[model samples]
Target: MSSFPDYYKILNIPKNASTDDVKQAYRKESLKTHPDRLANASPQEKKTATEKFQAVADAYYVLSDSQRRREYDALYSTRSSSDKSDDPNASSTFFNTFANMFASAAGGPTGTTGDQRGQRPDADHVFGDVFEDLLRPEVESRVPWWAWLGAACGAGIGFIVANIPGVLVGAYAGNRLGAIRDAKGKSVAAVFSDLGGNQKAEILRALAMKVLGSAL
Candidate 1:
């Protein structure tokens, strides 16, 4: 499982977002994805809405607290982050359970899950600048705060642009249901690196389908 949930990405907030900003986002998102809003949607659509709702709640829970988030940062230090790389399937389930529990406790899903035990793991992404690479904060003779901000914004734009190709390819590949379906129930799981051969790639992909499932 990936160590971080790419909190900024999950919340659609800049790394520099203030506490108030985080709260605003949570409120907006809750209104948008509440189960009541999804009640009329199809089963699959409802599931999607619920997952997104969970994400919003998860993002809020982490960013709302101060002490817990700081401690979380100390534990999972890294140079970068990604929500996709993290196991969304697992994270979503955890959040749903938490949300449900909270709802039950608070007169409930209508309000929020009151029971914290089943809730998703506390926000672990806002730890002290884990995305060190994305926010250089200095470039020329130690750039000033304004310059650093520009660079951070520029880096974010560039990052999105850089990801377009991969996103397109993944989207295209996602259409091939048959290929994904065939690579299930594999016999092995092996971690591959740059030195991995074509055979290794095949084996790993096949195994991934089995273990992670195509849709998941």
Candidate 2:
């Protein structure tokens, strides 16, 4: 009737659906259409998912509130009847009332000059920065040439002679002696030692290759 969105249709719920039904539908739809779920999807797919997810959230926001829902229904009902007679004044009045109600609920506009409109921050830029940061590759600390030399000497002596105990003892001694500082002033050896499972293994492999190359 009104040019306003049909919140019920957006949420895929019947007009007579209870609050619980609305909540359930919102949860189901939100999870299925959430942008985060399409992280690895194509750009167009992610954009579409984000738009649908926002619509679902907006629909839920209005429908979940009794007062807002009542106001929305009343405004639309008036607009629906007025539309039968093609009244432009009624349509304009409905939009004005909706805007005023929304502004009031949002604590009114903050600017002085009696202007009802407020400047909104660019949401795309904010979210884009967040996603970029999340997707950015981790920068590994540069391994100092001196540290590599020390690790190389340790590895050659430890492994070249095929001494398993020497290798273990050398590693322990190197970990204790090699106290290179990272950008945060933390010990690099200690940081590497604290790494878990595959991460530690990968770093160890690189260190081994460096040492083996130096030995040859």
Q: Identify the leading candidate in terms of TM-score.
A: 1
Q: Name the regions of candidate 1 deviating beyond 4 angstroms.
A: 82-90, 93-216
Over 63-94, each residue of candidate 2 has an lDDT whose tens digit, in order, gives: 66676678767755654433432122323333
TM-scores, in order shown? 0.40, 0.40
Give the Cα lDDT of each candidate. Answer: 0.44, 0.50
Let me know the TM-score candidate 1 reaches against the reference structure: 0.40
lDDT of 1: 0.44
Clashing pairs in 2: none
Query: Which candidate comes out best when scored by lDDT?
Result: 2
Instruction: Flag regions of model 2 displaced more than 4 Å.
Output: 1-3, 78-100, 105-216
- Candidate 2 has what TM-score? 0.40
